[model samples]
Target chain A: MNITQLPFIKEIYGFLGHDLVAAVIGILIILVFVPLNSAFLVWVERKVAGHIQLRPGPMEVGPHGILQTLIDAVKLMSKEMITPKLADKFLFWLAPIVIIIPAIVCFVVIPFSPLMQVREMNVGILLIFSFSSLTVLSILMAGWASNNKYALIGAVRAVAQNVAYEIPLLLSTMSIIIMTNSFKMSEITAAQSPVWFIVYQPVAAIIFFISTTAETNRAPFDLVEAESELVSGFHTEYTGMRFALFFLAEYTNMFIAASMGAVLFFGGWHGPFFPGLIWFVVKVYALIFVIIWVRWTFPRLRFDQLMNFAWKVMIPVALLNLMITAIVLKAL
Target chain B: MIAITDIISPVLVARGAFWLMVTITLTGALLAVVPRNIVHNILGLALAMFGITGIYLYLGSQFVAMMQLLIYVGAICMTYIFAIMLSPPLELELPKRRKAKVITAFFVSLVTFIVMAQMILSYKWAPVTSLSRDWSIETIGQQLLTRYFLVFELISLLLAIAIIGAIMIAGLVRRKN
Candidate 1:
């Protein structure tokens, strides 16, 4: 039977028969997947960082400290939530929720494999970028609501950094979209099956990778949460689950950026001797590993240097790459 | 989870969502003008922009909706927040409450709203005969570069000028300071 032809549950308690059913199941799956994936990534990152520094990471909680993050999660949940006395109460609470929602919503449009996406949005790439940009607003809110000078400075730096990096990120991505002629994630991935964009557009790939790192506030660009400088930056006053939520959003955003990088430049979900889902996961994790490697390997750039790199170097290069892609596409 | 679809049909669901978006937009508009705090006002503007994005989605333009979210909520709202933060604190500048001015402003706004509503209600709106259903990004791009080429170039020029002027003004202010 055609699923679209299924009868609507006319009764209040009637079963969800078709599209709604699929949507509900998708939401449930995502709800389970986001937190689990983020938790695992946290564990992996710690292990990777430790090994990079020639040390063994957490080994007490679970095998090779695999369950350490879960234990930390529990501890964070039980901690007390503190609101600064002079903070704007409404915005202080709203910021964390805002940050988390976009992080999860963008996941719906991310195509893991041909059959594995919550919603194959028509403009999936744009949707993800747009929603991801909301992270800046939340950081600003968190900083301002904390009523701390350090937090405010951190938030300002974050906003400036994000705005500066987003241009090159979008421009580089635009080159791929021009090549693929579609904003849908699945199409971008499918076009990459023969030869991934990284071959033709090496410069864009590099620009995209660098900008994604900055966009996610990963290492070198993580001046927003520079512990040594700003006393934990924007979330200086947040404690308990509130702070945990911010952390979860950050990690999940990193995952999204990596996945996007995989889909855009690398041949996503395409490999020999493995199922498409496995291939997709492998590519994403590989990108994530590189990001982690870069995070721990490189020293953070100064604020002025970061800004100059984006505006002076990345943007102009991306624009030139985009123009070349357009001319080549037209000539072909 | 139980399916409440029997009680709420698809049409009902869509209508509910539409009304919710409208309510959000209206509330945000109210908050934007009514809020005493500059931060609240900026947030309200962002909320309204979000609501408008939903409306654009319903109008079958996902690309425009995303652009709306990106440019207005992401870039413009952040700029406003940064400006507000850099400026003097609200507490330092006490606003003088004038009952007569408030009343006059309210009266003017009310008259404008009524006139606009009346005009909209009386007008016999007709759907365009040659409505193109091509809401794709490609079509939009082609149209902007082809049919709307001059307008597009003009808009870009305007934006470039505005940005340069802003920077020049800021530089002058910094020198004076």
Candidate 2:
């Protein structure tokens, strides 16, 4: 069903027109969902981390620390916003907003179900990748504006890792694109109604997953915010909500990356009995859970080792997989 | 009091957004030129690229617009910043200008501006009565492979050679050390 056909939406569309109504509704969903979804993910991550370490995390806020992230967000909001005397005032303030808008804007193209999604652009996957790249710029601004050496180092490391991993990420994704012959997220999903891409292209799926983990700065690739080493990395100088914005954007990015993985490999919104939206959510969360599990399971790789792994191992493997898929398809 | 809806109607809002993007592009261009700080210049260029992407969207090529964002805003600008930020600041200050040189530069820029403005004013913008052009990604991909295959491969070869040259230069420096 067309969203404009809905009674309330139709009323709004009459008053505001289709484009305005769509923009307003999208912004509303982003504003409402970003915070709540991020908070929930924070709670989940902490809980998962705790369980992995054989402990219960944050039990005091509510039963099993259910309200912990909410309280934590309040605490962060209430704290002082500090600007270092040496900092570049304009870009320093711009960093968090820059990081966030793109993170949330990515949801515009994400197909939660056949009926859902803010807008279905033709180049859905490219749009997401484009916005994710903007996040790198925000990190650069954050690191540079702060005028801290460690922050700069962390930012530089993060950029290098992201840029390196992005190659393999695109390569793996290209293989899927080759198979589907389309870039629209829903179309890609629909193409897999018969059999999931994971069954056909397992190698691409694994490479894609690993590349996404590094892309999101999740452990053991969490060198961007490595607490023990770089004192929270590029966000070392950020305080209160400013720091929390980065935290929130990180989880949202994880969600976006995981959702892409789900759509590409797991036959998005495709499953037995349950509706499309539920299956989609289940797949997204399942991918996210494995990521979090991997985070706690492994130790962080060394800087050189990380670069080597991306360039030497991941790229060649992903490229070989792409070529093999292409030849196979052409042969068929 | 006058009604607010008259001033802020949906039609006006869409036009206002396009104008906003135009203003952003101009501001970013000015920032890029005026700023003495290299980092600020990079940021401005990045911002301008975003504005240009918006303009591309309005011009009816979503594929090109997204590519502008992906290649320029995302990858290229970030690389430019990384190149500078990771190194010590360069001595980028302009030297004391000679009067003749200043006059020459002024005339060059003025002539360039006049030529561009004249071309823009002379050209006619047709009303978009039909969406005839298929600006799809697949069409573009096919065109590149079939029509522009040699040109694409040449560019790729050039980039590969440049990369090798850069590596050789760096290795030479290390050997000298």
Candidate 3:
């Protein structure tokens, strides 16, 4: 949406060129939205996990730990951004920034509401998916650059895991895109007015949920950063703000993945009584809450089992689902 | 805020950006060839592909740009990285004869470039008068199925064969282990 639609913004746009005005506003939105949303999601995850385990989370911080993540953010910012002396200096420095860029860029095309989006590209879903895949490259860089065996192993596992799960993820999403016949996020949402896609494409929805959890490195699929096994995985040597950027990007990715799920299967922004933005947020959070809950509930999967499941089961199932979807679409 | 048009027109900005992309593409290509490190070479190739994606975007082919990013940077580069990381590290030392080989490679590439440039310059390119302006995903799908059906099927068959070949090679290694 054009910020210049507002009278005050229109005045500013008259002084600045429209391109500059839009560019500035888009940057500002990402700057504010990414960190703020990440902080909020972190708080929500902690609170939900705490309650799930029958304890109050961050009670000492402001009421119900609302201010806890803010305090943590402050602490993280003050800590040292240490670089390992023997590490590849260029790649070590580049990895965290590279990881975060894709996470932030994906937000630009996300249709938050009918009126709220940075840019509504025709290939929005494709753009997000393509950029998100770049995250594995950063992870690999981070791991390899650390000059640590554990970090390298973690990176290898991450690349393997992401590469395997991505097939199922794309296949399932292709099912929905086939039905909707467009890659645009807004069109996908609009097409779901009659019924949420979860009803018709339950298998795809299930596969999507599973792969997304793996995609974001959450819980069961989080072998990339399995603390007990790999000593904090790919970001083992990263500290302070560098670590915080990875942490923030992880949460932001979780948010984006869930938002995509909501948009694809949960009838994004389509609900009674409430406005579209509110409904959209509600659906997204509901998915995020489920993700967090699942994280706290399940044990991490074995590395070999993860690969086996992706290849032997999920890929075939997702492919079958796609074929059926195409046949049905053709018949209709 | 100074108006961008006051210093340089929009067309000038676009032209400048186009040239910048071309420079990036060439530099990346040079890096891919000149780097001794295999990883650096892979990353340089990725950079070149990304610059080409930018060129595609400027040419009003957003779909193709996204696909290029998806297939080349996301899939192909990652595959190269995986193979690099998985395989044993190579010895850095090269044979003396490699210098002559490198010169021959450079000469061949230069000759090819000149031939391609001459061909491009001599050709009187004309836009197809009946070309459909629709660049949407739907139209692309229709064209692929109707106009390019056999070629599309052939490409899919080729991909399937490649995948099977990869699986067989990987299986051989596993069997050896």
* Per-model TM values vs. the true structure: 0.92, 0.90, 0.91
lDDT of 2: 0.87
True contacts kept of each: 0.40, 0.32, 0.38
lDDT string, candidate 3, A164-239, tens digits = 9889999999999988878889999999987999999999999999999999999989899999989999999999
Q: Give the TM-score of candidate 1.
A: 0.92
Off by over 4 Å in 2: A1-16, A19-23, B1-18, B90-128
- Residue B143, model 3: Cα distance from true site in angstroms: 2.6
Off by over 4 Å in 3: A1-23, B1-7, B90-97, B126-132, B171-177
Best by TM-score: 1
What overall lDDT goes with each candidate model?
A: 0.87, 0.87, 0.87
Scored by lDDT, model 3 comes in at 0.87
- Shift of residue A250 alpha carbon in model 3, Å: 0.5
What's the count of clashing pairs in each model shown? 2, 0, 0
lDDT per residue, candidate 2, A57-165, as tens digits?
Answer: 8788889999999999999999999999999999899999899989998999898888878887788999999889999889989998898888988988888988899
Pairs that collide in candidate 1 are: A9-B6, A10-B6
